[model samples]
Target: MKKITLSLSMLALILSIGMNEASAQKIKINTKGIGAAEKGLKAATFSDADAAKLAGEAVAWMDANNPVAGPNDPYTKRLNKIFGKHKNEGGLALNYKVYKVKDINAFACADGSVRVFSSLMDIMSDEELLGIIGHEIGHVANKDSRDAVRSAYKREALMDAASSQSGVVNTLTESQLGKFANALLDSKYNRKQESEADDYSYTFMKSHNYKVTALASAFQKFADMEKASGDNRTKTEKMMSSHPESAVRAAKILEKAKKDGLAAL
Candidate 1:
């Protein structure tokens, strides 16, 4: 009886230690490198509730400070309608808004918020716009923005900058947030990440029955713009800086479109 009791106590202690170890192990995300993993883990550390709260605050700041104009513009209405059409396709409650900025760029935040720029609309057709929107949506669905925020927090440049003096995790004013946004926009994503987002966008648009060729065409247009406007600062910068070279991006999209049997828009 004494031997049996001792055996049972040992077994219980071992089980307790195993459970504690399991609980203490950090959840690792399947990202590329240590840096990427760190970013992903930081983003994943936020509960769904906390992510939603932060997203809401960020959008509110954008809405109040950078109120998008041309709300009544036909193009604006059309863009909004298209976003509404496929908002729920990814099993997330997605919201869309346009920014009045002239820079030809668009981005999505975590919690399914998409922001499109007005200048991009001036250049892209409706179908092309869909492609851009789809790409931005992919980022949101993939939680790239959250990971990006985490990466920013880890960087000394971002941390020590005046804009980040308040800390990247804290609530920021519109101006402060704008500075952060600009920095992010200027940053180039790794080739692998860009490829993944491209894949996501292609799959998403095809699943939704959109003309995937529009993505290719959109890239072609940007490439042309880059070539034509050599010295013009606004045009060249808009066409060049914020994205990968249009030719490269377009070629990737074309290959995917061929595999997916994408028809022209």
Candidate 2:
């Protein structure tokens, strides 16, 4: 318990170093109707501001509820090392953490919060991890995260935004906050969104002169893990279930790499 508390304190310190008041101002949670969006009633559209607010709330809730790997953890230190080597030029001052969970997953929010599972870091190479992080950043750059949030929240978002316009405060309940976290974490993108993000990742790697095969290799690792788990694959590969099939995505990555001359026959 002491170790966990110490880790959390150190993690908070690192996070505070990476964050600034200006960044926090970008996602002001005090706005009216920002988080009070009701559940269900589809119409996937939301302003950037709305997405930022929800993302901030979702990340905050996730951080509080999850057992995050602290700064002193070997996995967390390694992940920070890998994450720091990248250039996040897609309009977000990204901050990342490794959650101390066995789930193999990583996600990025519109608010530039990226949470990666320690299990994922343990399994992936540094280059492979960068490819995955690039993919997550691609989602943020393409505004897919915002659209997913809006769609999952439905008309409630519009209503709340409207209420916000009228200066009516709309705060979320504890239940609503949990729902938002789940929605953000488990949101599924369509084939198009997934493919587009894949392409963005490819370009991101190529631009950095990183090995393009890292992306394909990462996907192949997931595919192998899936097959190895058999019936228990669902629990092991929870992050891949909502995504494009790993084998298919891997093939696409190879195809793109070859087409760009990053891979040879």
Candidate 3:
């Protein structure tokens, strides 16, 4: 759920593209440009609140930079229709939106912002998408988002973008926000954390009485996609490479579901 191996488009890592929905502004960021913001990052421990606030700023920048579907758009309408009722799932306040991108991915920020890509919605059924959403939110509910931002700042070698001697979140310049967002995007969760989030996702599905098989089915979809990969290593192929055990993981999920008497097949 941290980066849903389904469609986190490794191409975004290579190209650093951001397509805005409202103004349709496109931003191309390079490592050198990101380095410039290093001048503002002060070394400090990022508190949970600070992490959430920083996440909020980063999400705001991302929402402005990415192609978010409008309220009237089918993607937005469908997400709203299905997830609109559960504003506060797993005791975490949440907001949902659809990004009109071809990438089959979804992510959640520490600030309770969840964005689903239209392509992901296209390939997945409602319950399966819900399972994916649950997994992503699991990352947040378990405070993985909080830890990820901290780790990201450290990995980027720029712990605080707040421009403060003491650590706290504050208004960031657009460029500074971009730097923070990049760091967040580059953050990677460990296998343990990801595994925990997957379990949390199943727990979420159980609590909601949603079809738990969707979780297994979702992973099976990833495995199937990987099998159907092309000769040239596309971005999806790269993503699948990073998560080579998709089919195995899916099998594990199915096994667990069968034990719980929840598997249909």
Candidate 4:
């Protein structure tokens, strides 16, 4: 009886140690994952291969589902011109398309795919449009889109109630795709990133000789729209929910412009 009890106690102690070690390992993995993300951001670079793969997947999904119906000929021409100038400038293969959404928004994916909304172009001048495009391009150059993609994937898994599935994940439904698009558009980037993108836009506009003031003007326009649509939950929520306040963004850009000797237009 004594021998049996001693063996049982030894087994129980071993099991407890094993459980503790497993828990610690999990904690270490979590910490390491977070550390890697932070390092990626600090480095401001992404793996070109990873970006291309993600872009291909995202484009395929968008093509099959949310087909954009805008003036592709003119838009593609404009994009080719802009991107052609920047080709070989960055390591990423930056590509763009104009989606037929009426929403005044634009977004870049981790894989160097940029989607601009038609309504966004309707509201802005050519210079203003360039500013917005430059900003999105900055996100790609900085690997912000890749970081956002990773963040979105994690968030979706955490938020989904039916996350217990094995192996492959299915494509999002149309509604889910819309939700994802909106989320990506309205997602709040870290302040550092926002500032960096702003700086990149300034440099891009300055280098290309586009009106840098358009950056601030774009934000002001968004801010005014937000104010005018007060309490109209949909517009207001869309404007303010995911992004930093337009006023704040405008102010920061203006400050940067002044410092960079870029006068208001």
Candidate 5:
């Protein structure tokens, strides 16, 4: 009995050490300190291969700066379960990580990395979360992620990063990675791309037999939250600034729901 007790204690100590080591590796990024490599860098076009390379660099930089929740974390486990159920149609293999951040945001990269903010998960239902995730996947399927990467990095810098792999393309330095990472955070999708992604998400839900109405509900929820902010940011201004307005998107989704006779429409 004493030997068995000793073994159990040893196992517990090992697990505690492992947990501490993992926690030590997690970092908090000072978003303000990170700046773009070049101001007003002219947008450049890139091949699919080049976009993939940039995506790798950006992911590395982000992983270093952001505190990523581990697989053992409940949030990470939940996200994995939800994401795992979906079979992505895009060519890129999708992988997800949960960032322990307060901001309510999520993003997908050209390399098919989806990082979800913990705050977003806190407020959204599983179905609503699926809708938002579907929208992000749509961006990847439509190659919008690749385009975003291209717009963030200069042609010369991207080419350099790509070539560095084979000694043919110039390689990206750690500093360069930081700049690209910052640019990615600041990257904006045009209205056209946003609309396209929305359409893709709708189709994805319809195909998967998920609740179509949930999409509308998610948008309405965001709209309500924005309104509650009680700031000068009107719904229209907010929509036009980047993504479509929540009310407008919610209306569009409801229209589709009604046409399909989905769930109490």
Candidate 6:
């Protein structure tokens, strides 16, 4: 239940999307206070290029550290078959890969690095998987991923870089990159951002002429998982969850689907 914000469900890695319940890795949030340089740097000063560059570095470090599915692996095959042609999805050129992990989650990085976990694939249908991944992509396209990296960049550029004289993100060491990844994943998306990501998932399906209902169904699956997990959060605990309940998100999608004649309510 760390501050990981995911799309369809909480993923342990808490990539751009977090696992609501998946607990493969528990990345402790950096509790260190911002330095004078980080405090002086305005969050608004970060450009889209800075976001992408930082994301690229962090994702590269993660890719090298984690076990990636090979080209001929079933996970990779499935992802490529479904998403290869859409490399330029959402106007961003995306690189897709599958992580051979047990965590049921997927995430889209700011640089359009879309990573899908095999465990998540095992549980979700292709269409449902698409919905979930689309939601993750929504985070990137909507700049949620960018925002997550901005904080990490600010902290790392100030802490690791010899001088923040250029007033932009600077390179980080391997150790600092690990911190950068953790900070990026620990970021939580507010209710509004989550809703927008859901909307983006819906739009992605609609545009692709895929089953838009899968978006709602995907949420329903998460809702069911939460229920089966015996969720008993108090108001304070629920508020600290960092994202809206899956049931509520499912309901919203169903309402929209019903209105659009895409699904029966």
**Cα shift from native, residue 13, model 5 (Å):** 43
Error at 231, model 6, angstroms: 5.2
Task: Give TM per candidate.
Answer: 0.67, 0.74, 0.77, 0.64, 0.73, 0.79
Per-candidate local distance difference test: 0.50, 0.58, 0.60, 0.49, 0.57, 0.66
**Which candidate ranks first by lDDT, i.e. highest?**
6
Q: Give the per-residue lDDT digits (tens) of candidate 6, residues 163-223.
A: 4554544544555545555667556667787778888889999999999888777777866
Superposed by TM-score, candidate 1 places the C-alpha of residue 110 at a distance from the truth, in angstroms, of 0.8
| Candidate 5 accuracy as TM-score | 0.73
- The C-alpha RMSD of each candidate to the native structure, in angstroms, is 18.8, 9.4, 6.4, 18.3, 13.2, 5.7
Model 1, position 239, has a per-residue lDDT of 24
- Superposing every Cα of model 5 onto the true structure, what RMSD results? 13.2
By TM-score, the best candidate is 6
Better of 1 and 2 by TM-score: 2
What is candidate 5's lDDT per residue for 1-265, written digit by digit as tens? Answer: 0000000000011100000011212333333333333233333434676666666655655677677899899898888777786645555588778878644556666777676667668877877777777777776778877776676565335654444444342345556655555555445565566666667667878888888787777677767766676567532223333456667877988897788888555
Estimate candidate 6's alpha-carbon lDDT, on a 0 to 1 scale. Answer: 0.66
Candidate 3's TM-score reads 0.77
- Give, for candidate 3, the lowest lDDT window spanning 10 residues: 10-19
Total backbone collisions, model 2: 0
Candidate 4 versus truth, CA RMSD in Å, comes to 18.3
Off by over 4 Å in 4: 1-48, 69-84, 87-89, 154-188, 233-239
Local error of candidate 4 at 5, Å?
Answer: 62
Error of 5 at 195 (Å): 1.3
lDDT string for model 2 (3-43, tens) is: 11100000111111011111110121222223455333223
lDDT of 1 by residue, 1-265 (tens): 0000000000011100000011111112111111211222233254554445444554555555563657787656978777767777588777777766534556565566666656667777887777766666655566655555444434322334543444333433344444443333223344444555666767876887888887777667766766677777442243234345567878878887777666532
Stretches of candidate 6 off by over 4 Å are: 1-5, 9-44, 155-177, 231-240
TM-score of 4: 0.64
lDDT of 4 at 228: 79
